[model samples]
Target chain A: MSSVNDIQNEIIEEFNILGDDKESTIFYIMELGGKLPDFPENERIDSNIIKGCQSKVWLTAKDDNDQIEFLADSNTDITKGLISLLIRVLSGKKPKEILDADLFFIDKIGMGNIIGSQRSNGLAAMIKQMKLYALAYQTKQNA
Target chain B: MSLNVDKIRDQFPVLHQEVNGRPLVYFDNAATTQKPQSVIDAISGYYKLDNSNIHRGAHTLADRATRYFEDTRAAVKEFINAREDSEIIFTKGTTESINLVASTYGRKFLTKGDEVLISAMEHHSNIVPWQMLCEEKEAVLKIIPVNDQGEIIYDEFEKLLSEKTKILSVIHVSNALGTINPVREMIQAAKKWGAKVFLDGAQSTSHLTIDVQELDCDFLAFSAHKLYGPTGLGILYGKREVLESMPPYQGGGEMIKEVSFEKTTYNDIPFKFEAGTPNIADVIAFKTALDFIREIGKSNIKNHEDELLRYASSSWSEIKGFIPVGIAKDKISVISFNIREMHPFDVGVMLDATGIAVRTGHHCTQPLMQRFGLEGTVRASFSVYNTKSEIDQMTEAVSKIAKIKNK
Candidate 1:
């Protein structure tokens, strides 16, 4: 399994190749949403939904063999793609590893330029939610 | 006579700009109209020349600033055809203006079992203020139901009015749907029960001609920002008699006539409501914005905006998966729609990528959205400065976005 840094670096290189055109970047991001595994319909409830998002996003997590896996979905395609990127970098890692993970690739690939200003809040909220799941798993592990 | 769209667009300096490698197509006029060059200059000019606290000032700049600020109230009084300049008061924005009435007028007049009626399509500001008032006064808040076409049911509104109805406040033109309420008739009906009428003219004063005398509304609130002026400055036009009946909204230097530890006397009508140091520069600049609208004339501006809305609705209706949120026959300055299988936020982002600005989300009209069985719609509002070419660009971009999801 690749380290978190190694995964972020790989993702950054791919996004760098996508160039700086906002339209293309957004279109590419929407296209990337297709990479996410199908989100469970049963888990898409108010409790699972993240607050402070313009678009509705439902996030869930599970601990498998002491490794935390994050699952997320959004009503909007671009937001879905954004969460998929988070999942790509941080999923299948131990709780401590996920919690301590620094998402430097967000700035490196100029994700802010791609997602626009309003979506930046949703992206931040999503990252916080992912880390919160990791913290929950880490707490469970300690118990 | 029709307006010279090119000339009008040229007057707004902000229109001549690029966004994301494309010429910015600003269609978010309902949120806040872009300031014209004259309005912008007026703001800077005030700071450069006459920057001083208004009213009760002995200095030269203070007197000039005071005169200019009062001149805006006079201009607004004429623009809305108010009975007197003293009837017009300046607040921060439409939200504050509404809150002022709710707090001042509603607090004094309302009592147990009394009703404050509002329509379903009102913005959150309009609704929340009254809701807070109703909750405090032990009054019942009534909503006039809206039809599927996003218009308030006239029959329902009439039925909602009763002797217990103390005030009937409603939006003149819906920011979310652009439906123009028959406020003139509504005001006439409201008077039968002796209910004061407040028109949330935040969207109307820009696109429509507002003659407060003709409409007979007791109060009208609108923001200067939506009228191509500055933000953080709003006008509250109240009938002189009605304004005098209400108590002071805030306790501050300007709003008070005399102060003491035991007894305090408040100023008259407009000043009674206007508290603290006002938004002097913006208020002065607002006259220029109103002048910009006056020079163009409402009829000419309406014709251009109606043409834009007509072209956009017809153009976008042809696209697959295009669903219009509001289809009120008497709508103006707004076209609300959504693409099938796509969230409004997504469509808004896609349009922004093409430098076409549109408003998404609930538009602060959550109840209205719920009434339509929608979370939100993409609202493309037009101003006098908007052109058909801009609408055409938006149409193409929307069609392209729709195709992506529908396919």
Candidate 2:
């Protein structure tokens, strides 16, 4: 299993080649989302939805021993790509590790310039939700 | 006379830039129109030379500021053909203007069991204020439903109107759908039932001619930014009698005639509604926007916009995945649509990459989107300065974007 930083570094390296061509970059993002595994339909309830997204995104997680595995889906392909990137880096990690993980890839890849202001806000919200899930599992473990 | 499109485009400095390494094709006029050089100059010029608090100033700067500010009010009176300058009340924008009426007029006048009639296509601004008013006053809020084409059902509107309706507040032209409502007839219909009429002209003031005395709406609200002026400035034109009847919107300096610890007497008509320091530079700059419109003339502006709409409407069918949302027969220059199987946000992002600025998402008319069974739509609104070439570029770009999903 790759560490969170290892995956983020891989993404940064992949994106650096596509550099400055927004059309190619956006299409690549969408292509990545196309390859994401289908999220469970039953788990796609309003309770699982993340707020602050212009497009609706459903995020659900299950604790596997000490590691948390996150499943996410979005109505928009670009938003799905964003959440999928998050899932790739943070999923299958211990709750404490996930909570402590630094998401430096978002800034390094210039996500703000690429997604515009609104989607950047949604990306921030999705990260917050993932960390909250991690915090919940951490509390359960402590208890 | 044909509008000098090139000359007009030259006047707007913002239109000359690139968004994402491509020349900008600004099709988001419904959100807010870009300001001209003259309007920009008017704003900075006010601050540079004539910045001072008006109405109670005892100095030279105040005198100049006061005169320029009132000149805008007078210019607005002429622009909308309101009876007098005193009838025009400056507020934050259309949202605040609507809120002012709801809070002051609706609070005092709206009673239990009375109906505050509005249309389903209203932006949240028009709908929320009435909803809040109804909740507090024990009044009922009635919505006039629109057809599949996004035109209001005239017969349904008539049925909704009754003796119970205290106010009939409706948008003159829908910002999302671009539907040009038959508000003149609706206003006339409401008048017979003794219901006050308020027209939200945020979209219409830029596209169509507004003559308040002719339309006979009790109140009309619109924003300056949408009319090629600055933000933070809007006009609320209430008939003198209607203005006199309503209580003050907020309490502070200019809105009062006399104030003591014991008692405070409010001012008259426009002053009673305008409280404290107003948006001075923006209001003054708005007059130049008004002048800009007058110099071109509304009819000429409409002619160019109509052509752009016609070209756009006819050309969209050739694209594989184009599905239009609002097909209203009487629309202004807006086209709201979706690409088949692709989300509006995705379409917007792709188009933005090509330097096309179109408003996506719900456009703040969530009920209208619900009515159409849509999450949201991609909206392209045009102005006089927009050319057919820009429309062509957007169409080609949208075609490329839509094909990515279709293929």
Could you tell me every candidate's TM-score relative to the true structure? 0.97, 0.97
Off by over 4 Å in 2: A138-143
B1-407: candidate 1 lDDT, tens digit per residue: 87778888888778899998899999999999898899999999999999999887799999999999989989999999998999999999999999998998899989999999999999999999999999998999999999999999999898888899999999999999999989989999999989999999999989888899999999999999999899999889898999999999989888888899999999987888888998999999999988888887889889988988888888889999999998998999799998999889888888889999999999999999999889899999988888888888988888888888787
| Worst 10 contiguous positions by lDDT, candidate 2 chain B | B398-407
B1-407, model 2: which lDDT tens digit per residue? 77889999999999999988889999999999999999999999999999999998899999999999999999999999999999999999999999999999999998899999999999999999999999999999999999999999999999999999899999999999999999999999999999999999999999998999999999999999999999988899999999999999888889899989999999987899999999999999999999999999999999999999999998987889899998999999999999999999999998999999999999899999999999999999999889999999998998899898776
Clashing pairs in model 1, backbone N/Cα/C closer than 3 A:
none
TM-score of 2: 0.97
Model 2, range A1-143, lDDT digits (tens) per residue? 99999999999999999988898889889988887789999999999999898789999999998999999999999888877889999999999889899999999998999898867888899999999999999999999
Query: What is candidate 1's lDDT per residue for A1-143, written digit by digit as tens?
Result: 99999999999898888776788888888888867899999998899999988788999998899898888898888898888889989999998898899999999988887777767998899889889888988888789
Give lDDT: candidate 2, residue A7: 98
DockQ score for model 2, please? 0.80
**All candidates: DockQ:** 0.81, 0.80
